[model samples]
Structure formats: C-alpha cells, structure tokens
Target: MTSPTGEPARTRGPEGPDAPANPLTRLPLDELRRRTSMKWRTYPPDVLPLWVAEMDVPVPPPVARAITDALALGDTGYPAGTVYAEALDAFARERWDWDGVVAERTAIVPDVMLGIVEVLKLVTDPGATVVVNSPVYPPFYAFVEHMDRKVAEAPLDPYGRIDFAALEITFQEAAAGGRRAAYLLCSPHNPTGTVHSRAELAAVAQLADEYGIRVVADEIHAPLVLRGARFVPYLSVPGAESGFSLMSASKAWNLAGLKAALAVAGPGAAADLARMPEEVSHGPSHLGVIAHTAGLREGGAWLDALLAGLDENRTLLADLLADELPQVRHIAPQATYLAWLDCRDLGLGDDPAARFLDRGRVALNSGTAFGTGGAGHVRINLATSPEVIKEAVRRMAASLG
Candidate 1:
C-alpha cells in the first residue's frame, strides 16, 4: 500500500494501531457480558450488562497519550495551555470535511446535550413552546421542561421514520405558539438507529426556515453510522446555516465519562454564542479535548476497525433474534450501536424493563422511556464483544422461550 506521496503506507493497521498479535477478538460471551453489566448491582462478578451505550474497545493510542500527558502537568483547573484546543481544528478540517470551518466557532461543551440545553435556553423564553419528535432521546423533553418551556410531541411515523409533513406542521404550531426556536432533532435517532438522509435533513431545515425558528441538531452520534451510510452535517445541508451542529467523540469512542463535546455553528449562530458567559466553555476539559481531537484527526483508522466490530455485532444481534426469539424483531440499525427491538410480543404491561431484569436476567432500555412511539420497544447496546452480545441474546431467548 502506497501513501499519497507514493511511499509505502504506514505500517499501522487500518485504524493506525500497532496491530498487536492475537488481538482480543471476542471474549466469552455470557460470562464477560454478565460480569460487566451486572455492575449496576453488586453482582457475583458475573452477568454482562449490554444495556449501556459504552463500547468495550480500547482508546486510540494518541488519545491515551494526550490524556496522560495532560495529567502529567498536574494542572487540571481550566486548560490555559496550548494543546487544549489543538485537536478541534485538525479534527474539524479532516473528519467533518469542514476544510477550514474555523475552530473559533466551536465551543467545547461539558456534555454533548448540555450544549443543546444551552442552545434551548438562549433561543427560547420561559414558557415558550418547543417541538420534539417522539421516540426521541428522552432527555430532550426534560431539557425543554427544565427550562420552564412547553413541549409539543410529534411522534415519528410507523417503523420509527420521521414524518416531514408532521414536523412541518408541528413547527408551524410551535412557532404560532411563540416558542419559535424549536429543537431541530436527534440524528441517527436514539432508539431507531435510522440515519436521517440529506433529504430528511433538508425538510427539517426547510421547516425551521418557514417558521423563523432555529434548529439545534444533536449530532452526537454522527460518527457511528453503518458502513457506507452518508451523514450530511446539519450545516452542510442546504439552508442548514440556520442551525448548529453538536458533535462529540464521547458516543463514538466511549468517552462520555469524560463529558466533553462541542457545538459547531454558522456565522450567525457563532456570533450569538460569542457574547455569552466567559465561563460557558471554561477550558472544555483539557484531557477530553485532547482525546476528542485525536479521535477526529487520527482516530479514523481506529474508528474504521471499531465500526467493523460494531457492524459484526449488529448482524449477530439481528440473526440471533431471528433464530431465537422471533417475537423480538431486532430491527437492523443504520447508525449507532444501539439496537431497537420490537418487543411487543412479550406483551408485558407498562415498563418491561423490570420484567426483563427479573426474568430474562438481561438489562435493556425500555422503549416507553423514549416517547409516545416507544410503547413496545427496547433499546440495547451491542458495542461489546461478539461473545457477550450473543450470550445476552441467548439469555433473552431462553427467558422468552
């Protein structure tokens, strides 16, 4: 393999790792899965919990080095050094295809969704009405309501697809109700894994434009799309300048515990954020910034490999559901590692989460938590080793049987 300069490609494996010998492929499925997941409670060191969105993969080398180097200085107050925001620019230029999207327009937020909350606060007034499409990331409503704002639910259509017409209508009504600044959306939507296409995004932008409302696109999961799937940035889409794009390496690289993210906005939006509190971005977690930038700038190789692992686990999940619990239709995810399963067949009353825990000995995110459209669904994270994921499915199968 030759490099762009015609030299031999760097010996680093696809994801640029050293490509260690006999890499840890898949651990013992059932035991390891239980051991990790059962941590919610003091388990007997058994029972892997595939419930959380965290992946079991190791961090890329550069990220680890960056964190370690930052800590070596023993200065973690507020990142007043040089390397703090270095990764943001490089990452934006490369991975986001931004060419030169000005890191100055990007602000490192404490958490991905916090950026959303801040946007909602800045754009909407107290008691303002905001529109949200259901089966959304449940926290979305909480953010709106916490701000003393009103929430309007426009559930997604059957099969968990967005309804552009419905969104447009809701936008109009919300605008009329005086909460014109509405939440644009959750991408690769939380439970469904449906990757909103360029067309869908356009429709959303168009609706936002129609009502003179701002769009807050929560693009936290943009990097986790299925192989070959296209992710059009909210700002990249036509008329997307009316909105802002929220990005974080936390979800893709399992860095959520670090609590770091950024909001990349357009010229108008950037100017709005500029006048805000001086502490709004206060350092953005120097360690997290390093890891994030490394992931975006150099983690592509690692991401490619990780995505391959996730893709395999995704298939394992689908086939296992079919071969085992026919009623548990595991809808294939187009992006993100979360698997949305139609578990209506089990037919338990409201909140089947407890039922799965007690009987199936498996933990899952009950669909009802998401929205009106999540009545009989469950979201599972399959970002662990294949062995663990398979066993988790087996346990569910046995319980169902």
Candidate 2:
C-alpha cells in the first residue's frame, strides 16, 4: 500500500543505525506555538506545556490529505459504513497477529472514553461497582461516576504494574451483594507506561470469570508501543471472549480532534454490543472515519518514524533527568510517551506539578488527580523533540535553586 502522496508504505525495522531523520525535530518552536490545541493554548507563551498527552509532531501526510479531501468535497456528514473497522482489522492482523477482531463485531463511537462508558453501561447497572487501576487516566474516575456508578480502586504495584492480589481483594469486595461490576483495564497503561504482559491479562480474565465481573479495556495507546515492549489487547487472550476493548488511531497518529474510535466486542458479548442504541453510532464524525481509516491503512511508515523519534526522546529524558535533577526518578516507559516521575524526594510535597508550574514555568499533570498512588508523582509527555525534553528538565531543576 502507498500513502495518499504515493509514497510506499514500507514497514521500517526497529530503531538502529539506519534510523530515518527525526520528524519531531523538524517542527520549530514558533510553528508549535501557533497550534490552537489544548497543549499550546493552556499555558502562557513562556511556560513550556508538556502536561497534555498531545504530541508536538506533524501528522502523517496521508491523514492530512484525507481530512483535506473531506473538506474539499463537503463530505462532513455523520459517519457510516465499515471502513474504519476494516482498516483496524488489517492493522491488527499485521501488527499484533490477532484475528479475533472482525469489522462486523465493531462499532465506531465518538472517542475511546465515551465508548468505554457506553460499554460499561451495557455490563453493569447504575450504582454497580466499577473497578479501576488507580493512578490511571483521571477521566476514568469522572466518567464512571458520571454514569451514576461507584468506582473501586485497585492500585498498581510499586513497580507500576497491576497489583493482581490487591485487585482480587477489591473485586471480591465490589462483587458482594450480587452487585454487577466491570473492570476498566488500561493496557499499555497511562501515567505509567507499563505494557501488561499476556500472562497478567489472562490472569485478569480468569479473575473476572471467577467473580462474574466484566472487563472493559481502554487500549487507546496500543499503537504507540516503544521498542522492547509489546501491547496485548485484552480480548486477544483466551477466556477473554466476554471482555470489551476500545482502540483508536488518535493518540498514535495525532487525530484526537477528528473524534472517532472503535468499541470492539468479544464473541461472548455480541448480544450486548448489538443492543447498543442506534443513536450512539451517530456521534462519530464522518470526516473522522475517513482520516482514521487512511491512517490505519496507509500510515505505517509514518508511524514507524514516530516510534523511532519517541524512542530517542525517551532516552534523552532519562539522561537529562539524571544529570540535572537526580532527585526526580523516572523509570523509562515501555510503551506510551508519558513518563511517571517519583518527585517525593524533591521535597516538593504532595503536589509537585503545582510547584513546577508556578516556579519552573513548566506545566505538568498533577498526580493527585489520578487518585491513590498518584501523590508525589507527575506525568510528563515525552512525545516532543529531544530539545524540548532537555529544556523542560533544565527549567524544572532551576526551579529548586
């Protein structure tokens, strides 16, 4: 396959001596400041904004062309057809070797979070308990509660992987009174880039089966897995046929503004997925389907380039943090561009992000908002140029002095 621009969509090998030129570094600071996205507009000009998960890199050429074509033809109606699902099926087969996903078993929703909320509603009634891994995406707390559901916390281990022992305890507690519950699983977990192993996920499926709990996985960051790490979809595991998974090209290809994501149903949950209200399908934007499909079908080479750039930035961040601020410890993430830092030793108190923003003029996500294990932690986006990562750390170090 070739990109819209006719460039061959070659799958580049892992990052090594022959890595291509860094596309991230090509975007200048002045150009970035002109962006109207939340990352740029959320802070003052002098404050380096690295808090949001948005990437600073330009999108793949094919995605841009697809969007432009939609506008030119005035094809911005409600989304229809199975193009997005078909593209995802192709990408998954080649990328993950998972064939459980078929276009017929998927539905396009506005985005991953909303898709997850809808799936949760299908499994649990209002006021039922919903289990989540804390220090997770903050929206997990808000959206679940918004649905009139109760949330139970299963905090991750010290190493940032899921605490299954603790999770079993929480699941048992939540399952009392015959209350239906669901687990909001974040594979290639956010805040901390812990790409869950296949065994761990199978164990979760086993626990869910034993407890009669439904599992809803948010896999938005699956496509962004860095080198030395692999992402496993929750439904791909054996005994996971009852689970639901949500994925999108938004995070990997920077198409969040386009507003489209897929909610996939395992074989066992086909009836629940088919029962999803028809009105829910109308929420996805037509242009989003076109752009996302193009991304999945023709943007492999571009994605490979992006993973290479992020790989470099991840290493640069570790080196910079060690040289400039050894007190702030970061475990180099295995998947997403996010870096969860242990800032407690910095003597910055419970909320280090607040101090960093006020004193260092660098904005970061406050760990407290992520719940439980989040205190004394901050999530940083490392999806930008190495220069930006270095400068952000430099400014942070100077804040202490």
Candidate 3:
C-alpha cells in the first residue's frame, strides 16, 4: 500500500514470519511505572494515566547513542551551528518531498511552545491579538497571554476542520483598531488529531494575507502523522512564504526532557527571523541538539515502527469505545497518538475527565482546558501498551456502573 505521496504506507510495521517488534509493546506497566516523568508521577500509583502527551517507549537507539556520545566527550556546552535545522531539512525532503527548510532561515529555540512565543514576538507587538483555532493546545492561550498578547479564538468546525467563516470574522475583529495581529496555526491539531489538508492550509494563508495577519505554525507533530494523513508544512503553501513554523522531534521521538526545537522562517519571512534575539538561540541545550539531530537524521525506521504501533492503537481505541462504552464518540485520529473522546452522552457534564479521574481512576486531559468547543470531551494519550488502553476502558465503563 502507498500513501498519497507515493511513499510506502506505514500502517503496519515490518512484517515477515518474524516481524520487527512494536515499540509500544516493549515496555510493560511495571517497567513504565519505574520512570518518574510527569505522566507517571502526576497521579497516584493506582490511577491509569492517559492524559499527557508523553509516550511509553524507551529512547530510540540513534538518539540515545548521540546523547551518550556527546556526554562521553564532555561536549555539553551551548548549541552551535545549524546542524539541527540541516538534519530536519533532510528528514522533510525524504518524508514529505519538501525542500523549503534552509538552515540559514531557521533558529534553535528551547522547545515548541517557547519557540512559538519567540516567533510571535518577531511578527507582532506585545499588546496585539494572536488569533487561534480552538479548542487548541492549551499553551497557545497560556504562552500568548503570558507575553501580554490577547488570544482571540476561531473555533474549529463540527468535524474538527478550520471554520473559515468564523476564522475570517475573528481575523477581521483581531485586526480591528488597526492592531497588528498574528495567527497561530496548529497543524495536525492537538487532541482532535485532525491533520489539516494542503488545501485547507492554503486557504488559511490566503485568509491571513487578506486580513493583513502574520502566521506562525506549530509543526512539532509533523513526523507523528499516521498512515492515512499527510502533514502539510504551513510554510510550503503558496502565499505562506511570510509565515513562520516551529518544528521539533520531541513529540515524535519522546525527547521532551532534552528540550530543543527550531523556528523556521519562510523565504519572505527570513528578515523577520533574522531579527530574533541572539540570546534566544542560547536557550537550547547542546545535548538536545545532538539528540534531536540524530533522531531526525537516523531514527526513521524507529519512527515508522512507532507510527505503525500508533495506527493500530488508534483503531483499537475506537473498537474498545464502541464495544465497552457505546455512549462515547471516538473519532479515530488521523495523526499523533492522542484520541479526543466526546463523552457528552454519558451525562458527565462539561468536564468528563474529572469524573473519569475520580470514579474510574483514569487520568485524562479535560476538554474544558482546551477552550471553546472543548467541553464534555476528553483527550486520551494512546502511546501506551494495548493492555493499558483496554484496562482504562474497563475502568471507565465500570465507573459508569
């Protein structure tokens, strides 16, 4: 099977009489519990945590070796050069047939959210409005507001695609009073896992251009796009040459702790990117750059295996919800390992995740935190073992009884 891009489909891992192992299955609950990441430590020992975006897999060998080698040589200083951007360019070219990422037009930042804040700073003033499609990643509001920028939401359409009419209205309002505005786009949207089609993104670029709004995109989950959907980098679209993008291997490779990300500027936005403070580049850890560079350059096979596992998990989750909790509406995600479940039918008003955490002992992200159109829903992380997913469903069902 082939994807729309003509690349061989990654719906399943390498298959033979002896297939390559799935990464999600490699770590058991006992082993996972021994680690002390936020996903594991935020709740009690008894609770099943499916809330955070952290994956339940070990570090990919290539990334691990790179970080270890760096430490062995005591190469832990400030990050230097454009190696991270170069590696990402290679990955994008191979995986998405994109050649827009020039190392000279990219900057190293601490991570995706911080990178976004820094890029937003480049395009708009502190008091300007930053328009977003909600319910979006929670930090889109938090970080923008923290920087004294106001957030104006243009909620997604019912099927989780961009609502162009609402967006246009929001854009008009955001640009009112002759205020400089920016649009923060989350491609392959969080929680919903809705991968924006190229047409949709092109339309966005057109609208931003019409509204005199600058665009900044968070493309951190680009590599985690599953079998069916293709990730369209915002900067690759026409009329988007003035846009900015934030890319990272943290989510795809589960290296969030290492803390490295890139801020990529489209050709027309190169001058804006150049205006970014030199101190911002100092924020990324040297080890993080090495780890992310290695992952982007050499971890393709591991990523494919992980995506295959996530594809299975996506289907498994839908089936489990259908059989065990018929009231829950599960839209199988097109990308990422997150599943957004609509539980309004269960009579678990506004925040179903709270009820699930309390009664089911299952920790999930509350939809309310994601802003407008988010109530009565919950986001579940499916990057764990199938056994854990099954247990979580059983507990959730039992809670209703």
lDDT of 2 by residue, 1-401 (tens): 54222323334444677654566787888999999999999899999999998898887789989989889998888888899999999999888878877877898899999999899888999899999998899999999999999989999999888899999999999899888899999988998998888788999999999999999999999888777766678899989999999999999988889899999999999888998888889988888889899999998878888888888888888888889999988778878889999999999999999888999999999999999999999999988888888889988998998
Cα lDDT tens digits, model 3, 315-356, are 899899999999998678888889988899999899989888
Off by over 4 Å in 3: 1-13, 16-20
- Lowest summed lDDT across 10 adjacent residues in model 2 is found at 2-11
Q: What clash count does candidate 1 reach?
A: 12
Local accuracy of candidate 1 as per-residue lDDT tens digits, 157-228: 886778877877777788885545676488868878877777777877777887887888888888877664
Best by TM-score: 3
Candidate 2 local Cα displacement, residue 287, angstroms: 0.8
Q: How much is 52 displaced in model 2, in angstroms? A: 0.8
TM-score, one value per model: 0.87, 0.95, 0.97
lDDT of each: 0.70, 0.88, 0.91
Model number with the top lDDT: 3
Please state the error at residue 100 of candidate 3 in Å.
Answer: 0.8
Among all windows of ten consecutive residues in candidate 1, which has the lowest summed lDDT? 3-12
Angstrom error at residue 89, model 1:
4.6
